[model samples]
Structures are given as structure tokens and as C-alpha cells.
Target: MRQRLAFALGYLRNPRHVGAIAPASRALAQAILAEVLRNDAQVLIEVGAGTGAITRALMPALDRLDRFLVIERDPGFARMLSAHFPELEVLNCCASSVDQLPLDASAPVTLVSSLPLLSMPKAEVQKCVSAMLSLMTHRPGSKLIQYTYAAPHLRPFANIPYGWRWRRVVSIWANLPPATVWSLEQTPRGASIVH
Candidate 1:
């Protein structure tokens, strides 16, 4: 109850930064993070990590010594994140500037974003996603995961030429307004040609 109240107050105070009123459920967050861990992604990038609810769930799912990078535009939340997860690399930056992230292309990266894409201007959201995709390692099995309360089919970047296949992985009704998980897989051109 305390956590929910804190999240509600946080969201009310800053809707743009908080994004959602309630943090994702532990079960749902774990399920999403598990998929990233399963892919053995060397680097994990989290955008809009408000209050680090997902971050809390993510840490246990990750390998003992994996590198996790979190980006939060809200200075207060960024400080909270830093205090909560001191070991992680927390950047007080926006998702749209994802390309500026200090990551290595030699390693595969899995981006987990909680940004409210449905609320943002389409062009801005597209730019951020595009930048993140560009930074991703083009390895055959690399992918990204995004969660939203809106319908999966209504996603703005559905037709983008990012060579990614977006699929709805799971839906959690137990959450405040319920949420859906969207997984993006980068399909190789050769494989697409064959199919």
C-alpha cells in the first residue's frame, strides 16, 4: 500500500516522468526480464525507470555479474534510482538520446522501456525507438521489449523499417489498468527473403 501510494503521488506530481501511476506487478516485471535474460543479452538498457520498480524485479532475474544501464529523465527519480541501485549505471537522460549511451556493439543489448509511447508525440517516440534499434547489435537473435497499457496493434512504430518483428508476449490484468508486453525481434534480411 505504501509503495502504491508513493507511486501515485510520484505520478501525480510528474506525469511525463512517472508515466504510469502504479509500478508494474512483480510477476509481470519478472516475466519480461526473464525473456531478456533467456537471450543472454550482455547489456540491459532500461528507459523511464521510474522509482525502479522494474529495476527491482530485474536485478534478481539477471545473471550475478551482468551489466545494467538505466536512463531516467527525472532528476528526483534518477537520484532515487541511484540511491536504490547504487551498483548500476544510472544516467539522468531521456530515452530519445539512446544512441549516446556508452555501449559496445560487440555485445548484444536488450532494451527494456517503460516510456509512455502512447502519450508522447509520434515523431518523438519514433525517433527514440529508432535510435535504440540502431544501437542494438544486429546479431540474429537480439531483440528489445516494451510494455504498454494500450493495444499492441495500435503501436505507432508498427510499420517502421527497423527489420523488427513485434509480437505481444503477455498481458497482465492484475495490474492497475492491465498491461501488455511487446517483444521486438530483429529479423535478418536473408531470413526474411527465405520466408
Candidate 2:
């Protein structure tokens, strides 16, 4: 109950960053967790984790992951998340700085993002998208799972990377305004390091 109120306040303060009035619904969180469980990843980084609604659901998979970094741009939300989940490595920073994190390149990474790409400023979006792509590209077998409020068929952003492809994972209508989950990954041929 308290979490809901804080999340609502967070949204009121910054509609674009918070994205939704309420935190991700139970169904939406479950859907994302299911996807995470299906894919075996060494490192799991969740970006735009507002108020940790999905973070609660992801706790179950904590045992399997070597590293779990929760990235929340909002300082208030980040502090709240850190307080709530002391076990997690919560970072208060923008999504565009993902590449700067001290991550192990040998470990496969799977980044779950809740950023509202379509509605954000284009320049910021491009920087974030490029950063995310670079992180995934450097770590072989890495993939990025992002959810958007856009149509189910839409790829999160256009420029499909060099060899990466987007696959629609699931469309969750139970959420506040509904959301579609999409994953960006290297095609089999693109899995190997080319540069």
C-alpha cells in the first residue's frame, strides 16, 4: 500500500520518467520474470526500475544470477529501492551510462528495461539505445528485454543494430496502460564478435 502511494507520487512528479501511474502490475511483473527464468544469464540489470514493482518479482531468480544491478534514474526511487532491497546493488543513474558500469564481459548479460522510449526525447533515446546495444554487443550471448507502451508489433526503436533482431515476447494488457515486451538479441550468425 505504501509502495503504491510512493509510486503514484513519483509519477506525479515526473510523468515521463515514471511512465505509469502505478508500478508494474502483478501480471506484468510475472510475465517479465517468466522471460528472465527462460533465459540463462550471468548478469541481470534492470533499468528504469521505478519503485521496484518488478524487482519484487525478480527476487526469486536472485539465487541464479551472479550479479543483479537495479538501475533507477530517480534519486528518490533509487533510495527507496535500496532501502527496501538491501541485497540488491541499486544504482542511481541514467540509462545512457550503462556502458560505464564495471561489468564482467565474460558473463552473459540480460538487461530488462522499463524505459518509455517512444515518448522520451529522441536524442536521449538514441544515446540510451546505443549504450544498451553496445553493452549487449560487447558481452557475447547477451540480450536486452525492453517493454514499451507502444503497439505490440512495433520494435522498441528502428535502427535494428548491425546484426541484432527484435522479437516480441508478450503483450501485457493487465498493466495500467498496457505494455508490450520486446527483446533485442543477436541473430545466430551475429552472436560471435565481429569487430
Candidate 3:
């Protein structure tokens, strides 16, 4: 399929970022969006949205008041998403630069990501995760949905910030390499905001 070929090409271009040769399965897409469906959030922001795999699943849930932002660092993938999914407002930028966006703090937001966290350098991974956590603090109760090929038993890195805990864990066997989806929420109290 077109998606499979595009994904393969992207992976070939940058294996560290793309992390997989095939696009996510519809089952994985559906599972990711299901978390958004369960929440009443009106704003959705997706990071590393390669080829709009998850953006397509988010379409039905969008309304006039809703804001869906898809961020991709690759220009080729950004263009593809813009051309194919005209409804999405795709931002061609790195996930680490998300803090620069003029995101509304008061609005409820749901963040879904396909970023290859496990493969990224520890510092880069921490930067992106910290930026997202900063956003969540502004929009209390905001949730972050991320998928990894790693199993649930694989613990988070020791350096990861505290005050964020998993709300749900789903094993998606239908994906190319199989993945586990982690739905996360900030803890009610406080954890020193990491910069």
C-alpha cells in the first residue's frame, strides 16, 4: 500500500526517527483514538505524526471548536500529510520544539504521539517528554498517549520525571512489530517541573 511504501522510505531515510518499516495498523490507530474518545477534551495535538497514520483516525472526532495539530519534523512527511489530510493543520517542526506553539492552556488537550522514544538519545528523549509535561501542567487532567514496541514489563528510564503515571496500557498485537500503548496523566499533586 501507499502508506507502507512511504513508511518504508521514511524508515530508510532515518531509521532512528522512523523506527519502523510499516505504517501503524488500523487497529493501532483505532486504539490510540479510543483514548481521545473516552475523554471530553476538545483539543488534540499529535507529535511525530508521520504520514498522518493517527490523524486519519482522529478525523471523525473533530468538530468546529476542536483544534487538531499534527507536528512532524520531516518536510516530506509533512507535505504528504498536508496534501492528503487537508483537514489537518500540520506543523513542520520537531517534537522538542512543541513549547513554541501558541497552545491554549485552559483548553482540555489530548496529546498523542508516534515518536520513537526508545531509540532516541536519552537527552533528546527527556527534552521532548519534559516539553509535553510542561504543557500538561497548564491544561490540568490532560492525557498523553504514546506507543512503544517494548512490552509493558519494560520499565521507564530512571531519569524520567515523576508526577506522571500511566492511566492505561494496551497491547496492540495487530501492528507490524506489535506495540504497547501507554495512556498517561499528570499526578494530582506536584512533581518539580523539569526544564
lDDT of candidate 1 vs native?
0.76
Q: Rate the local accuracy (lDDT) of all candidates.
A: 0.76, 0.87, 0.80
lDDT of 1 by residue, 83-132 (tens): 98998999998798887766565677788888888776678788888777
Q: After superposition, how far is residue 94 of candidate 3 from its true place, in Å?
A: 0.5
Q: For model 3, which pairs clash? A: none
Q: How far is candidate 2 from the true structure (C-alpha RMSD, Å)?
A: 3.0
Best candidate, TM-score: 2
Model 3 per-residue lDDT tens digits across residues 1-195: 888888888888888988776888899999987777877887888999998888898788887337888999888999999998887789998888776678775776788989988887778888888888777767776888888888765533334346666644688887988888877776557554331
- Alpha-carbon deviation at 89 in model 2, angstroms: 0.4
Please say which candidate is ahead in TM-score: 1 or 3.
3
| Candidate 1 runs further than 4 Å off | 64-66, 137-140, 188-195
Q: Tell me how many residue pairs clash in candidate 1.
A: 0
Which has the greatest lDDT?
2
Q: How does model 3 score by TM-score? A: 0.89
